[model samples]
Target: MTDRLKLMQGNEAVAEAALAAGARFFAGYPITPSTEIAEIMAARLPAAGGRFIQMEDEIAGISAVIGASLAGQKAFTATSGPGFSLMQENLGFAAMVEAPCVVVNVQRLGPGTGIPTAPGQGDVMQARWGTHGDHPAVAFCPGSVREAYDLTIQAFNAAERLRTPVILLLDEIVAHMREGVHLPPPDELVIIDRPRPAGPPGSIGAAPAYRPGKGEVPAIPDFGTGYRFHVTGLVHDETGLPVNDSRVADGLIRRLHRKIELARREITFTRACRLEDAQVAVIAYGSAARSARQAVREARERGVQAGFLQLQTIWPFPAEEVANLSRRVPQLIVAEMNLGQLEAEVRRAVSGKAEVIPLTSGGGRLFTPEEILGAICTAPGGRLKKVVHQ
Candidate 1:
């Protein structure tokens, strides 16, 4: 791929990447830290022969995206804390009905508008569990401006290939950061559109439109594409009718999860340095991982065998990888801007095979490399200096 450098903000790069990924429709309400994404799409989508709509609210925004996806258009939306909160139900609806779309949440400090412009990794858990029930989610977290663009394209690809709602969770630091990025030529980038049926439409020989595809994903015929199918939140069979029978519901739920769960390696991506030969390892994602990487390097320079694991994919947490890393490293440092969310998951995965130490700050400030290295300096006996900033 030939290099074409562009001075772009992370949010703008994401919007450009979305267009390159063939996102023809965008429906979203303006929200702080993420409104630039909507603004860019509004201006450029029509020029690309696509559609963009500023909806009434976050809920309606996602609702329209879901409808567009069912109509066989690649769709997306962007939001922040409160707007992300408002999107939960429709997010679930998209998951339940097997709609493919992307949702970007540029996070801010929150539990109810604690801070708007400040950075926080508070929405990590919400990206996975904000929606109700036992639905599966594939969420990506990018740590740099370049990664923000690259991962946004991957997010759209995952949504198209898996037939599920994919979330790109970005902290304010990564969302608003401006830097030079070498973007590849649009034609050189591999664009995977949603797969279409092979056979001719409605002749003597044709497969049922509702037939389950790979990963138990139902093959949806685009609206007005001659084939019609039903969609509902209720647990249904291949035909998509509401069903209450216990066995039927159980099978339906399994299919929904299989799309994301069954292809773990394909969907999960991470960056690790010196992990195989390290005694101490730090695990982090989003902006927190940026500091974690620097801290690990500084610790290694101080004659400590330190490693860093940066998560590019946050959801469907890499259980097998985390479990194996647990037995290898004597101490695992789980760092975050929020209060110990991924730490709990790592602890459970490690299962006491190694010491699980958490480095956290919830008052919206990101962890510095010194702060993380401090945790590394003081071990089982020493407390993490200022675990909560507030």
Candidate 2:
């Protein structure tokens, strides 16, 4: 453990984890809080017999990643808020074509570059619905550098397994923070490559490239691998060719959503601290969870039964977990770096079962433990009654 331990920043952990997960191609533009990831990939990928390219912009970056992934290279890209917005079109394209790729978004304060060096969780809703049209999304948000490494690999695994784009959402605070991480040995890592075609169900002939197998995932072969197939962003049939029929379009889109919706339980990752028997609970993710964790500990020290729930997966939102926690506790506090983006979702999940309180910051700063502890100690009745804007 000691030998594998290293002091690494969150961005560095993500880059290393992608490599460990078999990523061989990275194409991204440098953006604050996320540039380190691209830099590390650029510096280290070539030596690992991998390839790295700095694209002119975020749009091109994600497009290149999709192309590389289709070409059979485990590929990814990195960006912050503004860049993430630019890549939305291509991100949707990747989802439509069932391309396996990972997009690391180190979120900074934004609505047109609000603040590059500041942290914000405002993109929670955007990450889930930024792209046009209806499409399934898989995204992970890590609360620490260690989780950053672990979840980065999980992101790639999910992308490959689902044959869809995955988002690794980070905030500026976590991206820049350094922590001592004990990386797992390479042998212990569970790496999963996308399923390849083995011909159709019977007959022993080539399988339809976009045909759905178990879990609605298609075993599309890699480009240039001698298997003839087509990949397109437009609605298509099982053969991967574009089709204009409403029935074909409807079925294809629904199946794409079904692949992820059915796997919701498997994709959602969460950590709860002392939530088993608590009078009050705090739900948070990313950097905000760090402070929330500290606050939970201090609340217990002061004889308050405060629990903490940290969301490691942001998209395909953990509505069930939040709903369950709401039924258990009379009050739930949601701490985040945005203006209640996820707080709204928690309210919808709780469905009036509990009083949902929001402790939010407007980016650039983080909540101190005392801030969250105050909210926990002052819950409704005698506790919190309104949003606590930090």
Candidate 3:
């Protein structure tokens, strides 16, 4: 590991990592808890010959980023709360068109700009299903400044490798927290480049022409190239033209789902600490995972057989690992900053094999160590009691 460390805010680290990952375009509107990312990108991206645009609104910002990405430049945008809501339409468009780009959502309390500057993990489920339809997108969360850097690069890599929009889900606390992060040496990082077309530039003879072979991710031809293709929200065939036929719709939909689901092995990552012989496991992610880690350590010190499963990838849910752990452990506590979003998934995965408990709080607050321990103490059959807040 590189020993050189400097104190950096999470948003700064994300902007720095995007630049290092070869992202050359950023377009976003200013929003609290995430504006720092845009500010840094505007200043720093120019230094690296990258383009930055501060658009009028979040919708335009994401639309511009998608446009840039289709032009063969890695692109990104950042927002929070209401801004994130504004970007949903374009985000859905990006997913539908298979536009590869990165979107950083520094989440704040919300239903409608609920708390712009306060920390909250309320966007966990939104990150998965905020966009319409059955489109699958990869979403990752970073609990620390170092992970803000690492996962941002991973988000870009995932977008290019899968030819889809990838979301970097960060809460207000993680986005604002300043911590020492050791910058990695340039040569040690692995960066992914998008697939390129195999044949000569204008080899495809017809309009809306392209080939994405069976079980293979297609190379996206950049716009401004001689080869013309259609981009739209409507279901389209492999050639990129809108098709109203059911067969074409079915194939397109299945491919979109399969392409992401089949790549789960590459997308899923989680940390299991002291789970080998534990009887109780705490499932957590994002900044909430930080508190859970501390709680688990303290629980272990008190002779409790507690362990932690810290998720790095939020979407796709790591079901297999969660199921296996659920079976091994007698009780499972799903701690999140939302009201049981992930806990529901944990219950489905375990299938009643273990006692599933939810410890959640919303509106810009986190579950503290003492609160977690209290949950542990009050667990029925040694499992935490489900606490619901309306």
Candidate 4:
């Protein structure tokens, strides 16, 4: 049986879902829009037999979470744009070490803390290219509080399964919004744990800790569990020690990307609403999608055949599906809080298959449904569409 519907804020849902996903440690510094996650985690984690820590800064926060994950604990951290920027270097370090952990970025107006309490999705590109190298990036953006809860658990599972850091991107709109949701029973939820080396730490042959056992991801044993292995930021081999050879470096980097690229089908997720036999389609995500959905309904009311595409997975973007939509529709409208961040990706995916129209906002407010519906009606065939509507 499902639990009774309970009202919860988006950030609170993320914290609760993390707990349900077997997160035993949380390290974070409080920031606006995202502080509630840390606050709720602080109060709830200890009671749930978990640990919570408030680090001096965002860098230390992510570092601690990485360390905790290495020591055999499911760990995560939450922050906003400014804090997320501070964690980029260590985020790269986590990728290099192949540590499985989750990082939540509750986006706020940015570039340097533009607005602490306002919502903005300018981090869409940064979430994928924040770090300084060619490492794999996995990120998800939720459109509602319920999606916040579901995607948080999925983020943790993806981290463990992919052996990399997974980002859960939220905005001030959803982060603070309250919604009623019926949570699934704990036993019914699927929780994925990282693969651990067999035979405890030292019972069998002294194999390399990073050696791939079954799949591309290695089953590294927990630190201090009688396993002797090195972990470093430099390019390393299966033994986890630093390597200097070019071939070894190339191989390591390629494997890091290949593991994630090969699993694209499993990681990418999206929702197409009323796309069949539509004249126009709107691609939106996060809070912006809430408006796009209503716009679609309103457009239908006005005799405009409009569809909505909700992007749940932002990075490693659902390009193929977007291309498919472009083939079917004559025009595609992309609405987002940021100025054409993801719209650029959609254009690349469309590649002249259809007309690309962007309705973007750098301002810290959401676009209204009427605003989107206007774009849907006036996109490219404004005069002709009006005649058809009449």
* C-alpha TM-score for every candidate: 0.94, 0.95, 0.94, 0.96
lDDT string, candidate 4, 158-233, tens digits: 8998889999999999999998987777998998888887676566754688776555888888888889999999
lDDT of each: 0.86, 0.90, 0.85, 0.90
Backbone clash pairs for candidate 3 read 379-383
Better of 2 and 3 by lDDT: 2
Runs with alpha carbons beyond 4 Å of true place in candidate 1: 1-4, 203-206, 380-390
RMSD of each: 4.8, 4.1, 4.7, 2.0
Clashing pairs in 2: 378-383, 378-384, 379-383, 379-384, 380-383, 380-384
TM-score winner between candidates 1 and 4? 4
Worst 10 residues of 2 by lDDT: 379-388
- In order of TM-score, best first, we have 4, 2, 3, 1
Per-residue lDDT tens digits for candidate 3, residues 85-169, read 8888888888887789999999898878788888888888888889888778689999999999999999999899888899999
The regions of model 3 sitting more than 4 angstroms off are 204-210, 380-390
Weakest lDDT window of 10 consecutive positions for candidate 1: 379-388
RMSD of 2: 4.1
